[model samples]
Target: MADVNCHKVLMKALDYDERGDKEQAIHYYTMAVELILSIEDKEKREKMNKFARQALDRAEELKGIKKNESPKESGKKSIQTQSASSPTTNAPNKTVPTVPTHSPKLEVTSKEGYTMEEKKVLEKTSTINAKVYVPFMEIDAKERFNFPIPFSDKDGILELSPKQKKEFVQWMRISELCQQPEIIIGTNPDYHAIKQTVVSDCSFVSSLTVAALHEKKFNRRILTSIIYPRNSKDEPVYNQSGKYLIKLYVNGIARKIVIDDYLPVGRHNQLLCSYSNNKNEFWVSVLEKAYMKLMNGYDFPGSNSNIDAYALTGWIPERISIKKNDPDFNGNQVFDRLKEGFHQGRCLITVATGELSDAECDRTGLVSTHAFAVINMAEVDGVKLLMLKNPWSHLRWKGNYSEQDSRWTPELQRILNYDPKMAQSIDNGIFWIDYYSLLNFFDVFYLNWDPELFKYTYCTHKMWQSGIGPVKDAYTIGDNPQFSLAVPQGRGSVYVLLTRHITSIEDFRENKEYITLLVYQHKNGKRIYYPHDPAPYIDGIRINSPHYLCKIRLDPNAARKYTLVVSQYEKTTTIFYTLRAYCREPFELKSLDTYLTTNLQVTGEWNSSNSTAGGCQNHKTYRNNPLYKVTLANDGNLAVELRAPKVFQVGLELTVKELDDSSLTAPFISKTTDNFRSGFCVLDLENLSAGKYLIRPSTFLPNQEAPFFLKLKSSAKLQIEKEQ
Candidate 1:
């Protein structure tokens, strides 16, 4: 009943405040608080506290604004303020509300009267609600997590009580006043057998340690390390001769501390005062105190469970099934424990691998761990030398110029701080390379890989002047009587300098994808692909049609031979071809070999039996049917001959088509010109790169005034053969 009444009063207050009725809002706020005090149920305490906070906020706002009015508006504003200050301001004294009382403070003292000043503790309004008062002194607990302070010496231990922990935690949260502390956990193994047998003794531990040792005149730093005795002869050895480089972790940061059998003269088999020692008693004691505080299910700084730093860093990999060799042991119990630790991000495991080779390591010059190899970039005896240690800790790189040697130069002596003569190099005896050298080496090698690629295109003068200048061209070839193609002129000029001489060709045409012609002129074989000297002439060409619209690759060696086979399911159409021979002076082909032929057997001949190079020959009188064929001899010279073909006209036609950006069609060469050939026409095809394109050609029948759809039985194929 009380909670319901409190809720109703709060809702009414909210409505009054939203409607700008300040006096009504105050009346509702006071009613809500009064209703909350009437509730006896513990569960209703939270509701009461919420109502109290709202009422207090409204009162504070109203009081603060009361004196902020001008003299002109004071008359009206003062009356409004007084009416809003209290719910029953207009009522008699009998209707006045009672104000809530503040909580009382607690005091404590020992029997001997050694009393500390009464530190006023914060009040607890409910089980989960409390207030924490600020302390007079400020202390730093940096890098310390789950730390515990000694309470035995203090006579009045109010701060050590469970109530104090809760109140202080709440106060810290509400006021955002608490500082974070660092935590450290460690694990290791100790030798417990006579012969140090396998799995003789080992244990793991996790704890929170003191960040720094605080004393009157000194502050000492304690680092954490996990150590294990390892054998050198073990396969894929981690350590040999019970010596290992202990992995040290400080505040989640990782470092390595070398541990071996060597110690001060008389100390044997005992951990020295080095950083790798197993003295973690201080941390263990602190954890026990913190664990006690956590037992009551309270969430204070020292009472909460902690997570190791390594776990948060995601160093642990995947888990594996455990196996055990001992008959007395349960199935894989040890492995299960280790696996749990790994999954919980508690274990920090380092994989052992061999050092990368000089080339494998890249430009960084970084050396990987191979059990005992040292890759310090520090200087020794004025010379930078990599120090490697054998896992046995007995054998080292103690050679001629070693740290203890006398043959070292002044630079080397200064680096190693060792001298057979005067020891001028020994300052503090710390190993170090020149700072600049170390920086340069690290920056060059350690940086990640990032790279880019660039491309360029070139053309020739004749190709540009012919209106083809490296652009798309359409040619036709097939069983049709005539094949034609048209090439469009490009904006750029392709000068003769682009192709002064033939070099070598890089091409592939066996597959339908990525067929291109690669022509390169190499001077010193610097950028050349072929080893042999090029013949300084064009070599191989393969294209869709028998016309000149095709790419040619130059073969540095000899006359190139290429086979063009088009496939349809299980069948193939073969088209064998060769280029005409040109003059020795670089001009187009000229000679009697270009014309009539008497004997079909003989190949290279001018004005004789087997020639098909320069001019067109009539097949009706000279041989019933003639075919112009280009062939290459075994001696590397090109030849031409005329043979009989099944069809009358063996040449293709060149057609040109153009379209504007708006798709408005332009006239083709056939529509605008009359000097066009029927059977075969010279195609101006110098402009074309590798990309998809559409070609539309329109034609008509002869003697027709108006043109009609002139479709020809034609097909097209693309080929680019590399020069041999």
Candidate 2:
């Protein structure tokens, strides 16, 4: 009989098949076949042949079927039977509402410059509770399912908690908010509609500004995508669902934020932060409420607009720093890149100015250390002009293109698409700037690319266990998950995007997830261990944002398997992550969690303190370092390697001691050499005694945590200490 693990994998394959995912089903089926084939015992193999044969047969049949054809309709025999609770049964046909028969032409597009892939990813992550919230759907609005949020006892039989009672009693109906609270989220999400109130979250609002800027050119910002009962005017119809769901990409996966209508109200029911200027337009207000709920409260320490852009659009942000005085500075090239990016519908660009004094900000008509959205660009008769939008409604630029200036003539206004009437209004946040003035004022720009740039992408969602007792950090090396990516031959770009999920509103906390992505190539034509090399294009160490992105360029010579290590500096809470690889061609991502070996071999990727942080080497940090404990029931040999970034040399030191209770100590062993490739410490012992041993691998470089491998070969069993 197959074991539980094997059985579960096969069942997952069956489920994927039922969901119209032939490719994923095939992957799971192949995993099942490999699992059984790995059994060494002859008796076990014979008994498991039933399962192994079934997996192979199903895989073959599925492969033979055309992708466009359904396997169930092909009438082929299935190796694994469907489970009992497959959710397909004869019911009233009312509960499981059928999706209305709408053609693809009915699909709505957004002005966020979303490519096809970005749009699809966004749609998948959004949750539509049409029966309750979107009553305009074919489902009946009065038919309430679950009451969405569990705040109070509906029966009135039990005592309500104080918090719940307050929320229940103070909950204002959507109908009572205004004389005519438009069901529509907004006429259109324009800059004027959003206003930052008490909370400090301009980065998020600036992201909305960018999303709102392109609606006239594209479709709608993701803001309106999840709103229910959108009327013919592109406004949402208000109903009694009393709840709303907004979609955001958490760590790479789409997570829905469920929120009730119990918004924080002051003397006059004023929204706390990020509200619309139009009194009755509640989308911005509702969105802020849902976000606060997701954040757990009113704690918005503020973050970069790029970070919020990723959550909103599912695009990976690229950071480009400006050094104006550098000899390599090319203003024309930068301008051309931005121009082409916007024209090709490939990027949403936003800029941040250097810190400004309060007086300077007010006098110069700019916000201090504020973010601005790039809406349009033009070069009319050799004069470069950039259209921008300040999230703040009144801070108009006082530069050459200022509203008070004479530069806004007939031809220039037409080129910049400026409406002189609207430009004079304080509520309209739009403005245009001279090309030279833009480069002088802005310090940094954030660019998020369209998903269509990558021909293929492979994404996997996982959870990393970090920050527990004692050290309160993640395992230094070894234990964290590693993925082996085989980048096939090509001259293309690849990006590894790591994203973390945002928690519920009341459960929100500052993200303490610091991650680094490292890649290493194979050596000497060996297949077992692919060591780390200081490769270029890796992201910086310890990025605290919800998302981290690193880029790698592949060429004809870069066709090989590279090991990708996802590591953390310190662990706070259990972090959920999604690892996404975007490339021009299809690639393979294989997990190396179970690829354990006892042979005295080499492992680990190469890294250096110069380019990246060297791990807990003595020279890097004098005290409080990482130590790995390995226990041997019998005699064994341990190899500690120190490899260089450029050269293939290795340096190492090995120390063996018994557990504190054992009261035993071995010789102080160390090795060094001036010869090339001489930095290696190998312990080759014969008739080695069997006992618990603590092996501390060190290097000459102080406080440097260089990558190394520990391979042990012994007759007796060996066990590394349990990793948290």
Runs in model 1 lying further than 4 Å from the true structure: 1-384, 388-395, 408-415, 418-724
Q: Per-residue lDDT for 307-365 in model 2, tens only?
A: 77766666668766666777777777888888888877667788888887888677668
Query: In candidate 2, where is summed lDDT lowest over 10 consecutive residues?
Result: 96-105
lDDT of each: 0.24, 0.54
lDDT of 1 by residue, 111-221 (tens): 122112111101110011111112111121111112152112111111233432322322111011112211122221211100100110100111111111110012211
Candidate 2 matches the true fold with a TM-score of 0.58
Superposed Cα deviation of residue 559, candidate 1 (Å): 42
Which candidate gets the maximum lDDT versus the true structure? Answer: 2
TM-score of 1: 0.17
TM-score winner among the candidates? 2
Q: Which segments of model 2 are wrong by more than 4 Å?
A: 1-172, 183-188, 228-236, 265-272, 326-332, 381-383, 406-410, 419-422, 425-427, 463-481, 500-513, 521-542, 556-560, 567-576, 597-724
